[model samples]
Target: MVQSNHETIRMNPNIQEKPETLTKLFIRKFKKNKLAVLGAVVLLIIILSALLAPWIAPCNPGQTNLANKLAPPGADHWLGTDRFGRDVFSRLLYGGRISLLVGFGSVAGALVIGTTIGAVAGYCGGIIDAILMRFVDIVISIPSIFLLITIVAIFQPGVEKLIFILAITSWTTTARIVRGEFLSLRTREFVLASKTIGTRPSKIIFSHILPNAMGPIIVTATLLIGTVILTEAALSYLGLGVQPPTPSWGNMLEDAQNFTVLLKAPWYPAFPGLMILITVLCFNFVGDGLRDALDPKGNL
Candidate 1:
């Protein structure tokens, strides 16, 4: 019955399994964290609502009803009306689009700036590395809030401008993180091998090195979105954020500036504050999950 083990092997090619890939392993590990998955789901729902605001919102966020000012949450105006009698629900939905956009835009811009500087500093070494890292330190020393206010004052308050402002002010952290990652990776065997083969410098940096450093870059970017949102909210407090008539979570809280509004119409501020909390917490959960999942030492 057990003729020859060799014969069984020859007849059972299908018995073998393919090696698991890094991406599959990462996904599998990420799925094990239940809270991260739940956070991702809630975040997706919020993002979808924001994207579908035009179709799902009961009224235009800017449309006001003087008679309905400060109306409580009800069927007529869900989540209630603000001081301007604008539909809070609609504003929240539309404002989500702005807030999410700012987060995404700011992070993306920062990544580009930071990654480039880091990659150059890491791969070049010597004078270039020292100069670039010192430049990053200089930027870090500058007061970010003041920088944001100055930029906003010059460019005017708007989503695009705020995105750029946050990107400029917040990129120092990313630059430092990326530079560290690059420095560690730049001396690796694979990088040396690529260089020895006479591969182009750009190719070595981007193709050989960048991919290796992407794990940290991605985690940082995820965490950066929450930071960017909080930054914009802080800017709103200083009146250096997206102006009224445009719905954004920051300016929505800006609506709660008056202490009286918090007391008289608690829902107005509560909803925005709740949204900010949820958004930040969800992102943090996802970032933590990704960091763990991407670790090479993690169980496969």
Candidate 2:
């Protein structure tokens, strides 16, 4: 009778699992995504190359060796030289640093500010939420690019100023996202239990609520990096961002905008444009994979 009962317990279909930790589950899901893995590898290579640009580059990106002006790719000058005799490969690697910096740095700034505003508004509700959301609505009503152009025009263009403008303009989306998240999460049993336990509102919001909403925030942030890069590129292409002599992909294309150069010095436009494409594509793939991997619904 004892053996039969033991066997019955062992064979029970309702037996619970050893709960998989979040890290373990995340790793398992992430590893299953081949494209995401490839994206990670590519992104890593780009980042490493950017960090080591000075050492890896054969020629100085800014130095004008007039003798090598517009030189095509060769054994010495890999990926060729630009109109001003700057090494294309060197500038590309260095440019990646600035582009990626702006992309990430601006998003970080926006994320912090937006998350705070959204969390506060959602958690506090009533008048505070109305006032803050109204402000957000006002900001969102304006054309973001036009607003950015106006701001940039007033402040003058440089990395810091550009970051500021982008940060200010970019946060609206994050605010909306977090606000929705907070609204939903505030009603959950865990949140009610925390409140009932006399957990401070601030602690409850940051500790319990924010963590639950981090998935969408992270996914949005990954996607935002690509958008920021493209925005910076567009601004630079318009001659309003990252001034000349500072190697950037957008300005590289701007410099090569001449019809004559487009046909003659094809390398000028091609390489930088290719970099933008690859970087954007990689970020998008990574974002998609992250969304699927992190989904709590297990839909992926």
Candidate 3:
């Protein structure tokens, strides 16, 4: 009788069950994505290279050698020299540092602003929600690129200014996503239980609700970094971003816009363009993988 009882307990579904933590489940799912793994490795390499640029760079990125102007790739100059005789390889390394900085900085700024607005609107609802959402709609209606160009043209263009502009303009999407998540999460059982227990509204929202909603927000942020990088590159290409002598990937391409250089030294434009493509693609793949990993329904 005791042996039968032990077997019955062992066979019970609830007694035998082992629940996985969300983070463990997410890791398990993410590891299965090959492209995401590849992207992460490539992104790590790019970031490390950018950080170690000063040590690894063959020559001074800004120091010009007029005699070696437009020199083709060789042992002395692996990627060749630009019109100003600056080392392409060195400039690319330094430029990546600036590009990555802009990408991360802008996204961080936007994330903070968007999260605050979204959280408040979603939690408060009614008049506040209507007002805040209408403002978001208004901002979204504007052509962001054009707005960015106009703003940069008005102010002195620099790294800090460009980051500020991009952050301010780019937050609407994050706001919408966060607000949507919060809307659904506000009514969840945990949230109601917290309210019933007399937990502070702020504490309930921040500690309970925000933690649950972070999966989507994080995925959005990863994807937004790529978008911010592209926008910064475009602004730099138009000569309104990081400015001359500052080696951002976009400004490097701007310098290579000459027809003669295009025909004669393709490496000048090709390297920077390739870096941008690779960086954007890697971020996108990681974001997609994160989304699939975080979804509980096993949907990709």
What's the lDDT for all of these models?
0.88, 0.90, 0.92
The residue-by-residue lDDT of candidate 2 on 74-123, one tens digit each, is 88788888877888899999899999989999999999989999999998
Model 3: number of backbone collisions: 0
Clashing pairs in 3: none
Candidate 3 residue-wise lDDT, 1-300, digit = tens: 455655776878566545768778888899899999889899999999999999999999999998999999999999999999999999999999999999999999999999989998998899999999999999999999899999999987999999999999999999998899999999999999999999999998799999989988999999999999999999999999998798999999899999889988977899999999999999999999898998878843
Q: For this target, which candidate reaches the highest TM-score against the unseen true structure?
A: 3
My TM-score estimates for the predictions, one after another, are 0.92, 0.91, 0.92
Segments in model 3 whose C-alpha atoms lie over 4 Å from true places: 1-19
The predicted structure with the larger TM-score, 1 or 3, is 3
Residues 1-300 of candidate 1 have per-residue lDDT tens digits of 775755766799776555779788888999998888888898999999999999999998999888888889999988999988899999999989988999999999999999999999988989999999999989888887777788899889888878888887777777888888888988899989988989999998899899988999999999999888888887876778888888788899988777777787977898988999999999989999898898898776
TM-score winner, 2 or 3: 3
Q: What's the best-to-worst order under lDDT?
A: 3, 2, 1
